[model samples]
Target: MGSYGKLVRDQIPEIITAEGREPITYIASRDEYHRRLREKLTEEVAEFLSADDAAALGELADVLEVVHALAMSLGIDSVALEELRQAKERERGGFTRRIVWTGNR
Candidate 1:
């Protein structure tokens, strides 16, 4: 037993069994899922920030997976989420301009 009390990928138990170790896991309730999803997103983001360029892509992928799960947990499909993102981007614009503001008027 690795003694992990954290959320893990769905296939993790199967993988553990294949490695000749038993993994104890249970499905999370909807409310608990929401809470854990928040934690997972923060974890993945921190990992992405701390990773080197070579490892960064993998970390980003993990972050994206967490994002997808979080969205789905909210009953938001990918298309609807993308639409919302685009709507916000169209209204407020994206970061492509690389603008910095220093104000003292």
Candidate 2:
């Protein structure tokens, strides 16, 4: 009985029906889908940042879901995405060392 103009999982309407509710929904066109995916990513990141200790992992998982969807929208599969990530890490290293940049000379 509420209005929410945002992207959601494909199974959400089915879940709502199972819960005995009438859920209004529609499929997004390709361009709209891409735009909404970006918005969803920002929303998910905010949730992840504000999540408490007990719920942090769950929020992080949601963020990951948005990320994967965004990547796929750009025609990148998981394997290819992983390869790009690894390539970047190899070139610039990762956060393992916790290196902090100080003021330059």
Candidate 3:
């Protein structure tokens, strides 16, 4: 059997079972769950960046789901997160301008 000790979607085990395979899984501790969720965020972001146009949206959705989990784990729900995001956007702005700075001046 292959080893993949990473966080996965809630329905993954069910999907595995539907495919005629039994998935071996266990519950992670609170700290371990937070750590794994962070790792999953990184993994999903990389996957989203590398995906082709046809699969990019799905990969991006996975990344968002991971981000949501991370926020919840940190005691910040979506509304709070969005509030923080807007505050940052108002103060520092966002990437809308597509500005590419080259070096310190």
Candidate 4:
């Protein structure tokens, strides 16, 4: 009977019901849904950062799922998102740099 007033994956309610538990839930308004999704992104990222390498992959998937939902919420598709990501990687490069700036260079 724990209460978690947070955004969850679409299948969560069904999973709860299948477990022989009644899941009390309601649809969020568009604005609220957007807000909750942002919160979920932050929450998932924190979880990923704290996980061990093996567990971090699963957490990373959760983070990507939130990213996909956020992109769709903003009317962008997966292909477009990936294109933007690639473009940015090409322009500014990604973590492959691993260049650590200590202090005043």
- Which number leads on lDDT? 4
Instruction: For candidate 3, give the lDDT.
Output: 0.89
Q: Please write out the lDDT profile of model 3 over residues 1-105, one tens digit for every residue.
A: 113587778999999999999999898889988989988888888899999999999999998888889999999999999999999999999999999999997
- Residue-level lDDT of model 4, residues 8-97, one tens digit each, is 889899999999999998998898888889999999999999999999999999999999999999999999999999999999888886
Question: Per-residue alpha-carbon lDDT of model 1 for 1-105, expressed as tens digits?
Answer: 112477888899999999999998888889988888889888889999999999999999999899989999999988888999999999999899998879878
Q: Candidate 3: TM-score?
A: 0.88
Off by over 4 Å in 4: 1-4, 103-105
**CA RMSD for every model?**
2.7, 2.5, 2.3, 2.6
Regions of model 1 farther than 4 Å from truth: 1-4
Off by over 4 Å in 2: 1-4
> In model 3, what are the clashing residue pairs, if there are any?
none
Question: In each prediction, how many residue pairs overlap at the backbone (N, C-alpha, C within less than 3 A)?
Answer: 0, 0, 0, 0
- Count clashing residue pairs in model 4: 0
Q: Comparing candidate 2 with candidate 4, which one achieves the higher lDDT?
A: 4
Report the C-alpha displacement of residue 19, candidate 2, in angstroms.
0.4
lDDT of 2 at 76: 100
Against the reference, the lDDT scores of all candidates come to: 0.89, 0.89, 0.89, 0.91
lDDT of 3 at 95: 92
